[model samples]
Target: MGAKDGRKGDPEGFGPIEDQFQAIFDDFFRRPVAGSGRDRRIPMLVSLEEAASGASKVIKATFEAHCTDCKGSGVLLGGPPVFACSVCGGKRHVLQERTLTVKVPAGIDDGQVLRLAGQGDEAPLGGGQRGDLMIEVIVAPHPRLRRAGVDLFVEVRIDAETARRGGRVNVPVLDGERRIVVPAGTVSGAEMRLAGFGAVRLGAEAVPIPAEVTAAPYRSRSVGDHRGDQIVTFVVGESSTDGQDDTSEGRRAARNQGLWRTGVLAVALVAAVIGAFVLGR
Candidate 1:
């Protein structure tokens, strides 16, 4: 019956039924705005060496993409005009996994994020621009090297003989190994600095430096022109007995020696006071 006839048996008119179907179809097949895409986070692990020298890392991520079956229209074809897509529950997107390689800049600190434009989820309806992928860098700890800003600190082991007599110690730098000269009577825990051998300065471009200032030790230079220094701390290792480690024993001995010197100084001060009192009497 026509909608205008208003038959008694007809519950709702054809126009209202069509309008209701259209509303349901519109809700099921809604399209997102252009240039809108899902944002994603990717955790990237990097070694100290990789952070020192820039590297490219690959990461795998899963995101929503426009459905291929429905062609982002959320409607089925080849038969009756189905308002909603049965495969995607009327949603126009499907889950997809992808892997991408990201270039990590040199001198990137831990917890820093790198943004990759248009690498995230694909835009809905296959028309708008894709979203961005954020890469979070996690720098792994080195066995010997500790990072502090752009500076690197490392502890080198030396035998008792080398600690007493002058010797050359091999220190690991970012690029290669550097041999450091140890003066005679060098004590344990002594630190030596090697200029331009540390972490690269991030965000600093290359710039010219003065020759005289470059020669000066402990001069802090800008990011691009100069690099930080590598600080090497000497650790004196004692010979072990019965194939047992002696590091703890050596540290205890060093502490005892300090206490003994302190106790002797205290005794000397007390004796000096007693002597002066007696002389004044």
Candidate 2:
């Protein structure tokens, strides 16, 4: 029998109810699929100070978007049955360049990911939605400082005399240079803490602490303005003054001369007193 000569009662063209049900069941049991467009990761390099203090950055990238002519439909506007779009060539998406100004929050650690919603490529077939753009932050290495969690570590080089006598050294911070006092007899790699002078965490405000108040041993803590500490590691350095006169050295020399004169005068007085006593005897 020919293929077209099938009997009406025994149909071979249409599938059985069981087969139809099986097909439906297989379709329903299929695994869920993710979105078509892929997410993009961009590396952003920022200075340590900038990471401490929140800053803004402008990002420029090329992404896929729905064609303006097709309006994401992949069809032309001319007829009842739509025609393929000439501009996008039925792809419905076009390559586009966009710029976004992203605000980088404070205390954003290295390798941290920042997500920008709907900033990635558009769906390929017929645009429905877009993916996200992820920004990975990278903190650049500093010459004299490093960060651990929220705390900042700075290596300060000071003269041996200054380290022994507890003098001040200029330390660099986010805002500016601060004169940090090195305790007397401080050794190499000794860390000194500067409260409220470290990196600012995210969502924390920068408060202006008064000098007198900071100097006070007992000060009340405020809310919503938490600041980390700066660790100043002292490195004993030598004075390299060949021709220029160091003020500290000059003062020390003058003080030594004065002490010598005083000692000589005291000895002469004692000798005179002994001579008088001997003559009286």
Mark the regions of model 2 whose C-alpha exceeds 4 Å error after superposition: 1-38, 69-92, 123-127, 206-220, 223-225, 240-281
Candidate-wise lDDT, in order: 0.66, 0.64
**Tens digit per residue, CA lDDT, model 1, 1-281:** 12322334455546433443454467444434554676778789999867765678887788868777777665665647555555554455677898787887877889999998888877766767788888899999987788998788988877776677555656666655655565557677988776666666775532222222232145554533556667878777874111223333444456788999999999999999999999999
Q: What tens-digit string does per-residue lDDT give for candidate 2 at 1-281?
A: 11212324445555233343333344234313223454667888888877876789887888766567866555576755655566655445567788888888877878888998877776544344577899999999977678897778887777777667655556776676665555668788887766766677667774532232134123335512556667777777786221222444434556788999999999999999999999999
lDDT of 1 at 127: 66
The local lDDT score (0 to 100) that residue 207 gets in candidate 1 is 28
How big is the positional error of residue 28 in model 2, measured in Å on the Cα after superposition? 21
Model 1 ranges off by over 4 Å = 1-35, 73-91, 205-224, 239-281
Highest-TM-score candidate: 2
| CA lDDT, candidate 1, residue 166 | 50
What overall lDDT, based on C-alpha atoms, would model 1 receive against the true structure? 0.66
When summed lDDT is taken over every stretch of 10 residues in candidate 2, the lowest stretch is: 209-218
